[model samples]
Target: MTTTKPRPTGSSGSADDADATYEHHLTADEQKWIDKKKYAWIFSIVPAAIPLIIWGVAEWMKAIDAPVFFAHASWFLGPIAVFILIPIGDFVLGRDGENAPEEFVPQLEETKYYRIVSYLYFPVMLASLILCCWQWKYGGMEWYDKLGLAWSMGMTSGIGIVAAHELGHKKTGFERWLAKIVLAVPAYGHFYVEHNKGHHVKVATPEDPVSSRMGENAYTYLLRSIPRQIPRAWNVEKTRLARSKKGQFNLDNDVWNAWLITIVLWVALVIGFGIGILPYMVIQAVIGIALLEFVNYLEHYGLLRQKLEDGRYERCSPEHSWNSDNLTTNIFLYQLQRHSDHHANPTRRYQSLRSDVFAPELPAGYATMIAAAAMPPVWFAIMDRRLMQYYNYDIERANLHPSKAAKLRKKWNRVAAKQQQTVKAG
Candidate 1:
């Protein structure tokens, strides 16, 4: 691993200061952990295990004609495990101690763990899809139950959403192909085109559907994002074809062709499972989209980049994204909360990602944030003040835009107005 010396935290001369602060380099023990590929494989298992086990147990319950309560309750367990328990474990149990040993930072260029994690994508996804098919076959679940499971299980973790995130950053043909396959499972294949081609380039700006604006609630964002993203994906693919002088129907390399493949898979599922299963498929897609939006809410909750004098947004840095060091959650989601580093270097594998202790931390893990987002006043109250403090530092070293500064002031004003209105009503 290439160890780039740590850069300073401030806007001006902090890079030099940051390098000076660190005297000791990586110890022998730290090097061993950094060098191994097995750690990635082991961590991948943490997220996949619970869902797979739930599917197996539910299947068994069906075989035995188990009581309805046991079988029905078991269905919700997998979603709870992924969204609730794992996030809580991450926030409460994963800690960086004061006495933790210093380690040499791994080289960012190495792709060791990235390769292994990418390969596991297919098997884990196939397993989840098979489980969904099984549930359709014998569980005799209603449309809503199957839909909920498909959305929460097959789409959220099965391969559609998470693996798409992994493949969206990769450059190789096989890596891109794998990403498309995962999207097919959720019938969200357009994400491969829009997310990779559009969102990354336009993130945090008005042009990106997935990027939430300041003061936008998650529910409001869902209303806009889902409808916007689908057509955006198609337009992006068409633009790419026009630029390359390729015919619109070019199947060999066109992203629309990939979407066609996803449609075929969707049709096959409907035909085999009866057209009644279509609603379940739609519900699962909705769930997957909900999970994705929730993740968007956390990625840059109250953050925005400044426009420079050159009429361009400042280049994204570690400071541009939120960071969380909750180890269990990091392990479970494949280091997703170590988001600052990922944005700084998009293609870096999760195993090699590091936490910037100087970066702002999320109050809780992603799951906690999801629950908190449901209550807007409470969530805004907790986060708004912290956002002000983050940007209100010494003028020579502040990391915020003028618009954001104005937004913060306006947010406080709105809070005061609401309080005054409450007092009058009371």
Candidate 2:
């Protein structure tokens, strides 16, 4: 079991109080390490290395008339490497101030290494797409192999999701454009507009479909979020165009064009590779979408802000978002586990993201959480209690009600019933 040491609460004279309670219950040394920019280089290396190796293997496989298994697998590797592995690795491997005697709070403001790492995302995405096409043409990969390729592409697109998330927070036009381009890779360009314009503005409130209400299961969230997000994306773009006095057909702001690009790309693949490639692409897309939803589930799982008497939700703070300080997963996924910081200060670079020791820590990294989400009863039994403890067992304050609780109970029971039925059938 992962143990997070609690820090002292309250403000101090220091810029970042090592003694202050963090959302994740980090120690003083962990706080100091997070404040420093020393590990930025490490982020750059892993993302770059994974794609370089994948592309090289893909080319070699093509030459040898072998199936591009690893190349296809590389797609999933990138997301797993970035989102699941990195943060978890960091939490487990990172040195706390207590363990490392040399640790000190650095005076440095930012690291150039982080900026370089941010730039690496573009090339990595491009290389993954190119390798997918190469494998399709030369390697003559089979259907299963193509499915792997699709999954890899989906994984590559998941990185694009990370990039979209990062750039969406920036104020500059260049940063925003980079973010849109990243979103385009996933054919999720609308996410750039919707997430910034809609989700963030309406987050943790009923208006935001992506925000999971207390007692909602992952399966329910997937059903609701996916369909809602697509229309929300369209509505957001339509609203933007309306404000600018432009029509939906206007190429400059048309979301349909972005989606068209995705369709055209798939059509080209089908034409070049045959009808089988279409299923491959669709499956790849599903994997990417699944990854996105899973992250969404992680972001605000079982957390809700209280509605004030004035009919407004409380201001989002570090406590509103779930945080994971796992060292490996943090570095790989670009500090996404430092979610509370991201919600509190959206524009801050991933390198500068800080964890709140006071916030609840996920029982495991996202990979494990995804698996756990599959078993609703077990997931609810485990996470429900943890959430209750985090919020001091006040279900009402956490926006949990008897009806929602009952629904969760029924969902879990159904899951058990189905499993029992499966066992009997087997």
- Model 1 root-mean-square deviation: 6.0
- Cα deviation in Å at residue 287, candidate 1? 0.4
**lDDT per residue (tens digit) for residues 31-131 in model 1:** 56544333534666544444466767777988999997787777667677766777777767765321122232334345465566656766776666556
lDDT per residue as tens, model 2, 305-367: 667799998666555677776665565567777787677667777666666665677776665
Give the worst 10-residue stretch by lDDT in candidate 1: 96-105
- Best by lDDT, which number? 1
Query: Could you tally the backbone clashes for each prediction?
Result: 6, 29
- lDDT for model 1: 0.64
Candidate 2 Cα outliers beyond 4 Å, as residue runs: 1-52, 55-113, 248-276, 400-403, 407-426
Lowest summed lDDT window (length 10), candidate 2:
96-105
